[model samples]
Target chain A: MSSTLLRTTPALRGALRASGALKATGALSSASFVRGKATLPDLPYDYGALEPYISGKIMELHHKKHHQTYVNGLNSALETIAEAEGKGDLSKAASVAPLLNFHGGGHINHSLFWENLAPASREGGGEPDGALKKAIDSDFGSFDTFRKQMNTALAGIQGSGWAWLVKDKSAGTLNLVTRANQDPVTGPYVPLVGIDAWEHAYYLQYENRKAEYFEAIWNVINWKTVAARFEKS
Target chain B: MVSLNTVWQYLALQSPLQLHSTMMSGDSFNLIKMGVTTFALPALPYAYDALEPHISAQIMELHHGKHHQTYVTNLNKALESHIAAVAAGDVAAQIALQQVIKFNGGGHINHSLFWQNLAPAGSDETKLEQAKELVAAIERTWGGFDTFKNAFSTALLEIQGSGWGWLTREAGSGGGLRIVTTKDQDPVVGGDVVIFGVDMWEHAYYLQYMNGKAAYVENIWNVINWKTAEDRFLGRSEEKNEL
Candidate 1:
């Protein structure tokens, strides 16, 4: 939350200069100078707001502990890459690519996931309408069928993963797919709705009976945000 | 599709050292790697359908052939890359390679133990009498065999994500028995001797048990290779001499 935007803070710049990584040019916009650290975004609603479907405790833990860890991890991985780059250690920076991908995808996935959820009393639940609904019905046959297929995808994940409703960029159609672990939905697809299948996402409330949690989560899905994303994409 | 008995005969004659290393330490990677080595998917001793009615043939086929094989394959690739990185003094590459090695290496190690940790249900090897020393130790720790089983089951069920549950002997001259859990694919490290391990990952039982993890946990006992547990706990005299 501090005003410092660049990763090359005084201490790091000093360290780099001391290591002779920074030559006498003193260039400010060097490619090695990492810009803007990623920070945890504020939840659109209160943690307890999505209660009854997802418990207040679960939401608090998911947001404060789990999602925050991803944020921290993403920032840390980026910082490590920056540090390595500053020290002219491209091999070390490249080695951190997996951590960067995992943590970065986790952050993006959780951020999108939180935005697409709302209280049942608010814009949550019900079916998508307008162009989004029409696209779903066209691509997946119907809204009900799409939901069933997504839920099935959620259940069929072999291990920790995410089931996503993605917008195929070329076809402009909706498709359901699953990604193992924190792998983000990428490659010619823009993720619309991502349902985390990792046990930690629902374990405290659902335990091994994940299907119930899968069913309950629909009650709080914000189709409005999903529509906006669809429209934007 | 080798028969367990046939595999046992082959093991007794030609592969006792490999078997003993896998059963004793779950560190067969080091034992097999005298130089640069490519880890292979170990052949299942029993037929895929051998543990059927408890775990299905489909589950075994995929779990071993597909899932475990992927780990072995990836671990080999990662190790080769790591060797190159080390030669080039690529510190970043070596550091990055650490996680993949652990994940895949632990997968190979754990699955190797997991395969031998089980026998076909109702087999003589499943009987606790085959592991008398371990049972006595379990009783001393938890006061009864059923109690220890219950405790271990609780630990397995309570795992929040993909992981493994293990019964290990603390390292040292007179290490005691303990129940522990490792997240993801982390192996039982710190010199602890893994007597047995239960895979809690969904792939291990989802095809057979689905979300009924409790049922999977309960029935797993029916196939537990207690004799292997005994050998691990007792440090079998012959195996000890070989080591």
Candidate 2:
């Protein structure tokens, strides 16, 4: 790396920033986007490290504000869900179901997204090796096939939604399923890999057509984390 | 994996004054008439940290207070002189300044469009049901809403570079479902009327997804204000003429 970039680098800043979830930054800092007690997730790396891939600005807008809103909304909705469930108010809970699902799902998806993404030099966001590749081949015929399938499935989602590669514990396999909006995976599975199909997930850059963003995000894949997920499953 | 090396941050820090004329604008705006950065940062639609988890607060601060603001500031400067040139008797200067004016101007315009494109994740409007007509139109034109998303997403995914992928509709055209990519600084409005636009320019994404444009696009959906989008769609009928 160039000394110029290395000089103004970010270090330990992510952890410090994550700790900031509990406090208001300035007089204008908003507590509205926060609802429940969950803390903000620190970025895996500095804001600029993802440069050339993700801009520092988009990252700032997307992570700090966008994801936090979901976290806050999820916390708020959960309170209602719990109260309704506690009272055995299934119908009421059902009424609030969309909120829990969308916001909670948004929180969950963004949390996973932050963890899955990383800078290029790190082992975080890069191409998979060995077993992950082999699995990609066995399941989808080839990496390209897997990519095409993922993009198609993700783009094919209607309205607000998500596309996921969930690890079905029962079948002992990964399944690609697209969920409408924040609908959770109501099955005996874990998300091996997933993509958030929301406009804020991309829009500022990729715009109306989501396919391009999906195809391009492959560059920063933290395949190692995914491999770990596969092993855990 | 798509190569991250392929995408680079293109920051045109050169003042628009060079590209534009030397004259200035006396026209008043919503801002102060005096000293600033010759550019002012744009305001974010929501509070900072509104979209968390999916996006980080630090990223938002820099993205909004820094990146988007730079574009807005630069655009204003570019336009200040271009408008001045036009006011004077400099047709050639105005013509030559068009590209810079458009690029920076479009950047500001597109980013402004983008700021509202999202809502707090999970902010669906159950109280409002105005999106039905647009949804119905999608089903009619693209076979189904699902099919339209597929085609639209495909257009976005397959675009070669940093450009927008939009679903434009005209009076005669039910829906121009196509994926269009603009080279650096070029943004094509979806409809002549601009139902809505996406800012695929790198400054928009370089913060979060880096060169992983696909991931950025997918995440954008979480915050997409379908209601607003639906409104844009509703304002313009597929087969009706604007005139």
- The best candidate in terms of DockQ: 1
lDDT of 2 at B128: 28
Model 1 reaches what TM-score against the true structure? 0.52
What is the C-alpha lDDT profile of model 2 across A69-153, one tens digit per residue?
7677755665565555556687876676566556656666777667677777776555577877787777778877878888988
lDDT of prediction 1: 0.74
lDDT of each: 0.74, 0.58
Off by over 4 Å in 1: A1-32, B1-230, B233-243
C-alpha lDDT (0 to 100) for residue A219 of candidate 2: 71
Ten contiguous residues minimizing lDDT sum, candidate 2 chain B: B2-11
TM-score of chain A of each: 0.86, 0.75
Tell me which residue pairs clash in candidate 1.
Answer: A92-B92
**TM accuracy, model 2:** 0.43
Per-residue lDDT of model 1, residues B1-243, tens digit only: 212222122223223344334334533343234233446777887999999888988779878997788877887787677656655555577667666667777787778779988999999899888988789889999999889988999999866558899999999987989999997787776567889999998778765665567999988988999887898888762322121
